[model samples]
Target: MTNLGKWTARLAVIVILVLAFVAMLWWDPRPHFERVRQDHVVHFVVFYALMLSLVLSLPKLPVWAIAISLFALSVLLEFVQPYFGRECSLSDILTNLITVAVATFPIWIGKTIRPSDN
Candidate 1:
């Protein structure tokens, strides 16, 4: 990756972190979309998008390394969820890993289909 791509990828990581903080920590009076939030389909789709973003942001990293890091990250987040007045479930952990694996299919197939930096 170019210097700009690395910086952009790092910025994306920060954005994802911020979004995670908001999604998992902050409480608000607005409609919480509980149904979708709890749905396995949503879990699959959201984490798939998330892993895809992570891969896109840091393509220089080894694929297995990314997968392992993300797996650990998910476990850590689940462990943290209880403190934030949220319930943690093994199902979520399973969903996360599965989604991440499914999401990375494109990368596993061949060279990644990256947008031109030109």
Candidate 2:
């Protein structure tokens, strides 16, 4: 694929992921009972995917910067849930951060071990 095609594909995926994040966080209409036991698991997986997509989508940027930005976005989204008929939970923020950490830790470690040629 051409450079332009690769970037366009990445941009499209990032946009879809961002929309998914917003919709899931702000507009989720699932019953509380259904989410009680599995909420953190959902958060962890979604954020993990988001983290990996972001790192791949923006390769020129530092991984630490991407992780920090994801954390900040998570915090912001969690805090504003109340206005959107959702209760904000500290646990979600913590889970999101933990997910980011888990998602990025291996990348950081691999770089440490291999020291990327770039």
Candidate 3:
């Protein structure tokens, strides 16, 4: 594929992932589950998936921009949760950061090891 095609495909994937995340947040079905123990695991999985998606989608994006965007999105979701009968928590924000860091660590290491273009 050409560079343009590859980028377009990547952008499409990113958009789809973002839409899925929004849907999940908007239609949380945790209350229907009988087991509280499982809810925590589900939440962690979903947030981690979002973090991973962000890491994979924003390779060319500036690191600070990516971090700021993730933080803002997390905060927005947390704040919006109240209307959906969910409580916002700092721990969730921290977890999202951790997950993003974990997902991007390998990319960071790879860049560091590669020879500079200059």
Candidate 4:
């Protein structure tokens, strides 16, 4: 397998860190959309990208391990959010877990449709 190098992994981690900091610290001005929870959606999308980035950067690791690790991190971060003055939500944690797992779907699709160099 071709390596994307350690830098891509580092970049992914950096993006996740920055987004998490903003997400946990800022009081969301608009937290919903027509009864759907916006925060939960944000958590889902953000974690999805995070999982993909991590796997792209660390292709040697199993996707299940990455998903589990990132899900745990999401849960741990939620626990830590209260210290930063943000309310923790089990719903959000669940959303994070689900989206992280969904991250593997795109990779699978991409591989299946990817063109052959030969």
Candidate 5:
């Protein structure tokens, strides 16, 4: 695929994933509450996908910027969960950070081992 086409497709996926994340976090809960383990898994998987998508879409952008921006967004979402009648907890934030760290670790390692020319 051409670079433009690839970028467009990646951006579309990122948008869809982000919308799903917001909807899952902000929308009313289902009739049955999810188990704690299930909830953590959901957070981990979604955030991991989000972090990876972001890195792929904006490869030129510094990894730290992407990680920090996503972490901030996660924290903001957690804070707003209570207003949506959902429980807000620190574990969710920690899960998000761990996801960010894991997803971005390779980029960090690559940059360290092979310093950028620019």
Candidate 6:
């Protein structure tokens, strides 16, 4: 695909992910799960994975920019949670960072294995 097309796709994915995260905050499932501890971790894992996937999808985006965006988004979400009756925790931010790091490792490996001709 062309660069513009790729960028458009990545932007769309980021919007969808933000919307989904907001929806989750507004409509939590912990009440139905009956085990808040486990449910919270599950939610964190799923959200982190989605965030990591979005970060990895934009191969042309700088790693530092991706990391900063991820951190900023995490902070934004935390600040917004109170409006939706949700409480944010530092653990969630840590989990997100770990997942993003794990997702980025493959990209790092690929670059190291195939250095550019330039």
Candidate 4 weakest lDDT stretch, 10 residues: 27-36
Better of 2 and 5 by TM-score: 2
Instruction: Report RMSD (Å) for each prediction in the order shown.
Output: 5.6, 4.5, 4.9, 4.6, 5.0, 5.3
Candidate 3 residue 53 C-alpha distance from true site, Å = 3.1
Tens digit of per-residue lDDT, candidate 2, span 1-118: 5799788868866776876576467534553766664777778767887887877677678999999999999999988989988888888899999999998999787767863655
- Compose the digit string of candidate 6's lDDT tens values, residues 30-117: 3454655554565565555565556548666776677668777877887887788877767666766666666567756666775464
* Clashing residue pairs in candidate 6 (N, C-alpha, C atoms within 3 angstroms): none
Global lDDT scores for all candidate models: 0.70, 0.80, 0.64, 0.73, 0.78, 0.65
lDDT value, residue 89 of candidate 3: 66
Show where candidate 6 strays beyond 4 Å.
1-28, 31-57, 115-118
In order of appearance, the predictions have TM-scores of 0.61, 0.71, 0.58, 0.64, 0.70, 0.57
Report the lDDT of model 1 for residue 90. Answer: 83
Model 2 scores a TM of 0.71
Cα lDDT of candidate 5 equals 0.78
Tell me model 6's lDDT, rounded to 2 decimals: 0.65
**Of the pair 1 and 5, which is ahead by TM-score?**
5
Candidate number achieving the greatest TM-score relative to the actual structure: 2
lDDT of 4 at 20: 60
| Cα deviation of 18, candidate 5, in Å | 9.9
Worst ten in a row by lDDT for model 3 = 30-39
Best by lDDT: 2
Candidate 5 per-residue lDDT over residues 41-115, each given as its tens digit: 777778877777776777788899999999999999989988988777898899999989988898688767853
